[model samples]
Target: MSNPAARPWRETKEGIALDVRLTPRGGRDALDGVETLADGRAVLKARVRAAPTEGEANTALIRLLAQEFGLPRSQVTLASGATARLKTIALSGNAAAIATMLETRLGAGRQTG
Candidate 1:
C-alpha cells in the first residue's frame, strides 16, 4: 500500500512539490486537510479568504503555506496552475524535512470520501 502521508507531495532535488486544491473566498484561510479526488489523486485542501481575482487568492495561498511550513514567503512559489483551483506549489528547502513537516501538520494518510 502507498503511504498516505506521501500522497499529496513529491520530493524534488530542490525540495518538495505539493499538489493543492484551493477554495477561494473562504471565510478564513486554513488548511482543510488532505482530500483524495475521484481520480485517486490526493491534494492538500486549503482555503483562503481572499477573492480569486488578480491573483489575490494565489498570493494568500502562498502565504498560508509559508506560515504552515514555517518558511519565508520567498521560499514558496506557485509552480503551476495559477489560474486554476488546483495548483502545484514548490518549496525550497530540504525535501525530507518539508515532508515531515507536512505529515506532522496535515496528519499522515489519505482522506477519501
Candidate 2:
C-alpha cells in the first residue's frame, strides 16, 4: 500500500523530505496538522514561538521536529525556504520508520479544505 505519510513527505535515499508551512512567532511550538495547498500539495502545519529573526524560528522548528521524531537536533535540517512560510525539511534516519511515524502522527489530525 502507498504510504499515507506521502501526503506531507516523501522517502529519500538519506531519509525523508518533508514539506511544511511554518508559522513563526506563534504562541508555542506544535504541529497543527496537515494541509493541502491549492496546488494539490500537502504540507505540515507547524508553529513556533521563536521570532523569524536570526534564524530562531527555523532553529525552533528543527528542535520541535527532532523531538517529535525522536531524533537528535542534527538529524533535522531546513532544506529550503529560509524566508518563506513554506519550507522543506530534510530528516536523516530510516525512511520507513520516519514515514511510519509521520503517518501515525498525521493520522490523528489531518485537515483538508
Candidate lDDT scores, in order, read 0.88, 0.87
The candidate that achieves the highest TM-score relative to the unseen native structure: 1
Give the CA lDDT, 0 to 100, for residue 112 in model 2: 57
Provide the global lDDT of candidate 2 against the true structure.
0.87
By TM-score, how accurate is candidate 1?
0.91
Ten residues in sequence with the least summed lDDT for candidate 2: 1-10
lDDT of 2 by residue, 48-82 (tens): 99999999999999999999878899889999999
Q: What local lDDT does model 2 show for residue 50?
A: 99
TM-score of each: 0.91, 0.90
For residues 1-113, what per-residue lDDT tens digits would candidate 1 score against the true structure?
A: 44854478989998999999999998999988888887877899999999999999999999999998899998899999999999999998989898888777777464644
Cα deviation in Å at residue 20, candidate 2?
0.5
